[model samples]
Every structure is written in structure tokens, then in C-alpha cells.
Target: MNTTHLTLDEKRTLDYLESVKTRLSQLQESIHFFLRSINPETTPGTVAWTELHSKFNVLIAKYLHLTNILNDPRIAFNPRNYTVFPFEPPANDQQVQNLSVLLRTKLFPELEQADEERIKEGTIPGLPALPPSPAPNRAVNPAGVNTPVGTADEKKQWNAYKLKVMMHDELCRKADGIFEQQRDMVHTKVRYESDDGDEEDD
Candidate 1:
């Protein structure tokens, strides 16, 4: 077994990665459980069923991204000599379904509850809602033009790429907002004038 010690920063990164791994496993297991309890034939096109698959696809895509980050070689670190190591990422294209048909096998009740709550309260102000995902194998371009008749793979890739871009842009926007808010905060300095008016006391 090849063992190596992690530096303080690397150890923190590893801890977070481990947590993400656990969450991904739990998420997949929950999805499997939900899938096992559903009747796809009976529930086709139903709101609950459609929504369940939609939510699962989104969550799984997010997990795939997290795993990708964890497996990134550029970020790998070792405590010894503070050196980096090259880590080969596992192949996971099969894990992210090229089509949504696979997700129809599940019903995510937790997601259903969350969706209801979100609908009642509404999303955050000033944030754009996610692009409305279309059914699997079907995608519309921003120009309102339909994809060429038989480019399923291209359509899927385009949608996935677009989704990632949107997610990242939203995150960056939130971060920028946080920085701006901090800058906008009114800061008051309490000053005491010493016996000598010439000297300013901080």
C-alpha cells in the first residue's frame, strides 16, 4: 500500500473530500431505494415522477462534479516536502446518464417536499431560476432553434455544459455580492481626543 502523510492544508482538503464521498454514496443509495419503489410504466409523465427524476439528475450531476474536483491531480498535496502528487481520475461518464430516461425509475420524496416548500416561499430575489430542463434527448438552443434531427449526444453535452456554466456563474455572482456587501457596510471609528489636540488617538 502506498501511504503518504498530508500537510495541514491537504488534510483539510482530504477531510472535505471524504465528506463529499460519503454524501455521494448516501445520495446514490437513496436514489436506488426510491427507484426500486416506483412503477415507471404507471407514472410516466406524472408531475411527481418527472420532478423526482429531474431532481435526482441535478443532484447526481453535482456529485459527479464534486468527485471530479476531489480526483483532480492539480490540487493533490502531500505533507512531506509539501509536494503534489498526480492522481488519475476514475472514468464516470456511465455514472452520469447521457439521457434522463434512466432517472424515471425513481421517486424522490424528500425532493418533492423541498420543491413544495420552495414553491410556497419562492426563490431568492435577484437570482435567476435555473434553465427549465427539457425531456431527455430533446433540447432547444438559445436562438429558439431546434437541434438537428439526430444529434442526441451533442444536445446532451450542450445541456450539461450549459448547466455547469450557469451553476458556476451563480456561485461567482454570490461571492461577488458577499464582497460588495462587506464593502458597503457602514464602518464607524470611535475617536477619543487626547489632552493634546495635535495627536489623534486610534
Candidate 2:
């Protein structure tokens, strides 16, 4: 919005930011789906499972592409310089790294668990098989190994968490839409005023 004033590099950075946001929304949807549907009994090779896995793989690739773009020295993309959203600080490098790790280490392993046969085969069309599970001693959570959602309490908690996350995402999207509309209106007003001044001069 009102990006006409931004330089070429800044505009490209903003575009990259938008791409990152869209990819992140997709990643969140995949995570939510896995949380809601994936269990110990989830059948592999099914349409839903296959499609989600493929989509997840695509999301991962797109995320990596975005990361590389941002990391390019020529781009020098700094999120802090462009404040698209009010009050929310741009994500720092640590936050981006944490997200990358969560997707790779946590989410990828969970996906592999859903289809052990495919994983064992070392490849699945769009997705690659993950390595063997880490040694128990080296696990991120040694005290609590990863397991499918089983207990009624666990299911309830997951559902609650998902609901909260979805609600927050919805609110943020709505706010962004409103902000965009306002920015567009302001831009249009400025353009009209400029036109009127030119007409007066003529």
C-alpha cells in the first residue's frame, strides 16, 4: 500500500515479505491438519494424506527459497525498515531460524511417522524420507518422546490450541485487510489532490 514511494530494492523486499507471509499461512494450515487428523491409525497412500504431504513439501521448498532470497547480500532485506503491520515487530533472524528448525526437526519427523513404509523406501514422490529417529539420549525432549495424539485429554488440548490459533490467524487477516483498504483510500485521495493541483496550474 502506497508503495509508489518505495525504492526498487525496498519494493522487492516487501514482495518477499508478502510471499513469506503467504507461505507461512500455508504451513500453518498443514500443521493444523496434521494436528487434527494424523493419528497412529492414519492410513498412508490415501488421497488426503498424499495431497497434504505434497503440499507440505512444496511449502518447505518455498520457505527455503524465501530464506535464500532474504539472505542474499544484494537484497539486504531488513524487515524493521518496512512496518506493514502496526505494533508487531518484524521477525528477527533467531525467530526465522527457530521456525525453520520447528518445521524440519519437529514437523517433518511427525510426517514421516505417519507413513513409515514410504519413509523406509527413502522417497515419496514430492517428499523425501527423513532419517532414522534420533537416539533417545539426543532427542529434543528426552523426557517425552514424540507420540500420536491418543489420550482424550491430549486430544482436547490439541483441539483447544488449534481453535485458538485459527481464531488469532483469522483476526490478523481481517486486520490486514482493513489496513490495506485504508491505505488504498489514502493513496487515492492524495492522487486526486495532486491531479486537482495540476488542473489549477494549467
Candidate 3:
């Protein structure tokens, strides 16, 4: 018997949800294209599988985030400006898992075939093996030194904060420049109109 209304905040939240959904759709399409390019009739293998797996996880996180936002008390009862039903969570489930297996068994061979074709056509150089990722080293405290156990983490956090501050300052500077440019443009237009009026009066 009771109807709920969306506040401006709720509407904004719904808009964000829609945007996330759109982004997920774009990502899915891109992965589909990648799969097709690797093998016309099958899915992609190891390297592509891992990459797609990571993407799927990201999408699932976004889906969960949006779902949580929708379920929040402030937003849940409200009649959303956008529909939030029929959850389209990112495709990291059984379907993608099966695809990965198929890629390994069938699509990888197809990818190898395509790679051979590319090599024959001189379009691509032979696939070079990738270098291994560097392992992170733990910082050790010197004997008799009174350094805290978390000092390394603290230092990393400080560095991150410093970088964030620098980026923010740079962005603000760019925004100021843009604002000045727009202001100058408006002023120029006003001066031009004044000159035109003076000419007409003369």
C-alpha cells in the first residue's frame, strides 16, 4: 500500500549502477571479440584464459558493489529511476570455467595455428617468451636497530599519499587553466558584442 520515492541521491546511485552495467557489457563484448580473434570456432587458452579470468573477477566485484549499493536501506526502498533487477554479474562462473577448459583443449591449438599463419604472412614476429614478474623483497631491520616491524608498510603508505597529493595538485592546475580559458572566451565574446554595438550606434 506504500509507495517509495527516489531522492536525488538515490537517483544518482541508480545512474551509477546503470553505468557499471554498461561498462560490464563493454568488457564482455571485448572479451568475446578477443576469444573470436584467437579462434573462430572456440575459446582462447592459458594466457587469454588468465587475462579473461582477471577481467571476470573485476566484473563480479563491480556487480557485487552495485548490488550492495542497491540493497542499502536508503536506496533499497526507493523506486529507482533505473531498473536494478536481473543481475548481470560478471561472467566468472561455470560458463567461463568451461570455456577455459575448452580453450585449453581446443582453442589453444587454433591460436597456435593462427600464430603460424601470422608468421607465414610476416605480419607478426615469432612469439617471444615473457620475462617472469619480479618478486617483492622484504625489508629487514638491522640488528640492534630500533626500527618498527611495520616501518616498510608505513613508508609505502607515505609514498602513495605523496603521489596522490602530487596528482591532485596537477589536476587542480589543469582545471584552473581550463576555467581561465573559458572565462577568457566569454570575455572575448562580450567585448566583440560591445564593439559591434558601438559600430551600429556610429
Candidate 4:
């Protein structure tokens, strides 16, 4: 196994990524609480609902800020050494869904492909190539086998990729939940107003 050390810039980028992950985790917890605090009976015009909505908005702003930071060309492309460009978060829910789908189906797969190429080329310095999979005729490995594969450096690279994908998934899931709730609240408010108008006419 190769044992080359990371350069100072790479070390800083990794540290920044860790801090971003921590921030995202905290935001997820806060969003979960926000969702729980919201209820069907919570009217949109009420003080409680307003405060909760304000807090939710702040959380979303922070999330968007983080997204922008991650979308930066420097950090976004650093993982695969500029082979893949990250997607920008869209302004609407439908567009966001499209972006999420694109990431899952296209961008992420490209990153994985880039990793495979890197491993084969031994271009990532200390990371080594993964072993070839066993032939189909070979005995099938039992489920839940805990065998480790590849060198430590190779494992580290794969873990970093997993972490990146996980972070994106977590943020998108939480943000989508919050947006759905907001839409529900708007619909509720509109129905309440319509009912009040009919009662006044009657």
C-alpha cells in the first residue's frame, strides 16, 4: 500500500468538508424539531406559526449558503480533481427535484466512474487499485460477510465519496420536507380565508 501524505491544501479542504458536515447535521436536527413543532391546527397568521416559520426560513437560508459553498468549483471538483462539476440548487421545488434526480442518476455516477479511473491509473498517489471481483463460477460470498477490501488509502477515498453523497441526501431530504410543510401551511391559510369570506357573505 502506498503511504504518501496529503498536501496542505488538501488537508485544509478535508477539514473544511468535515466542518460543513457537522453544520449540516446540526441543521438537520433543527429542521426535525421545526417540523415537529408545526401542527395542522397551527394557523398561518398566529404568532406561534409566524415564529416557527421564521426559524425555518433561517435554517433554509443557512442550508442554501452551504449549498453554494459546496457548489464552488474549487471544492466541488476537488474530490475527483475537477472531473465533475457540481449542480446548483434551483429556486423552486420542482426544479429542486429535477436537480436531485440529476445528481443521483448522472453526476454521482460520473464521480464514481472518475474514482474507478483514478484507482486504475494509480493517479491518486497513495491509493491503490481495487482487487478484481471473483469470477461468477466462484462460490458466492454469504450475506453479511465483513471482509475488508483494498488498501487503507483506497478505502479512505471511497469513504469520502460516500460521505459526500450522504451529506447531499440528508440536506435535500430535510429541505424538501420543510418546503412541503410550508406549502401545506399556505394551502391551509387560503382555505381559512375562503371560509371567512363565505361566512361574511352569508
Q: How close is candidate 4 to the true structure, as a TM-score?
A: 0.35
How many pairs of residues collide in model 3?
0
Worst 10 residues of 3 by lDDT: 135-144
State TM-scores per candidate: 0.26, 0.30, 0.28, 0.35
Ranking by TM-score: 4, 2, 3, 1
Q: Which stretches of candidate 4 lie above 4 Å from their native place? A: 1-4, 39-47, 76-202
State how far residue 184 of model 1 sits from its true place (Å). Answer: 54
- Which pairs of residues have clashing backbones in candidate 3? none
Candidate 1 residue runs with Cα over 4 Å from true position:
1-10, 37-49, 77-202
Residues 160-184 of candidate 3 have per-residue lDDT tens digits of 4334334444544554675577679
Q: 133-165 in candidate 1: lDDT tens per residue?
A: 454222222223344333665556455544543
Q: Which candidate, 1 or 3, has the higher lDDT?
A: 3
**In model 2, what lDDT does residue 105 have?**
36
Q: Please report the TM-score between candidate 3 and the true structure.
A: 0.28
Per-candidate Cα lDDT values, in order, are 0.44, 0.50, 0.45, 0.55
Candidate maximizing TM-score: 4
Better of 2 and 3 by TM-score: 2
Error of 3 at 38 (Å): 57
Best by lDDT: 4
* Candidate 1 vs. true structure, TM-score: 0.26
Q: Cα lDDT for residue 159, model 1?
A: 54
